[model samples]
Target: MEKWLVVLGIWAMCAACAVLFIRGATAGSDRRASVREGARAASRGSAGDTRAALND
Candidate 1:
C-alpha cells in the first residue's frame, strides 16, 4: 500500500507539471499575438494619418 501511494503521488506530480507547462506555453503565445496585433493597429493608424496629412 505504501509503494502504491508513492507511485500515485509521483504520477500526480508529473501530471501537474505537464498542465502548468502547457498553460504557460499557451499564455505566452496569446500574449505575443496580442502585442503583435496592437503594434499592427498602431502602425495602420499612423499610416492613415500620414495619408490624410498628405492629402490636405
Candidate 2:
C-alpha cells in the first residue's frame, strides 16, 4: 500500500510537470517571437555600426 501510494504520487508529479510544460510551450510564443525579432534587429544595427567604426 505504501509503495503504491509512492508510485501514484510520482505519477501525479510527472503528469503535472507534463501539463505545465505543454502550457508553457504554447503560451507566450508570439511574444517570444516578437522579442526574438527585436533582439535580432537590434544586434544587426549595432553590429553594422561597430564594423563601420572599426574600418574607419
Scored by lDDT, the top model is 1
Question: If scored against the real structure, what TM-score would every candidate get?
Answer: 0.76, 0.53
Steric overlap count per candidate? 0, 0
1-56 per-residue lDDT for model 1 (tens digits): 99999999999999999999999999999999999999999999999999999999
Q: After best superposition, candidate 2 residue 1: deviation in angstroms?
A: 0.4
Which parts of model 1 are misplaced by more than 4 Å? Answer: 52-56
7 Cα displacement, candidate 2 (Å): 0.3
> Over the stretch 1-56, how does candidate 2's per-residue lDDT look in tens digits?
99999999999999999999989888879789999999999999999999999999
lDDT of 2 at 49: 100
RMSD per candidate (Å) reads 1.6, 5.4
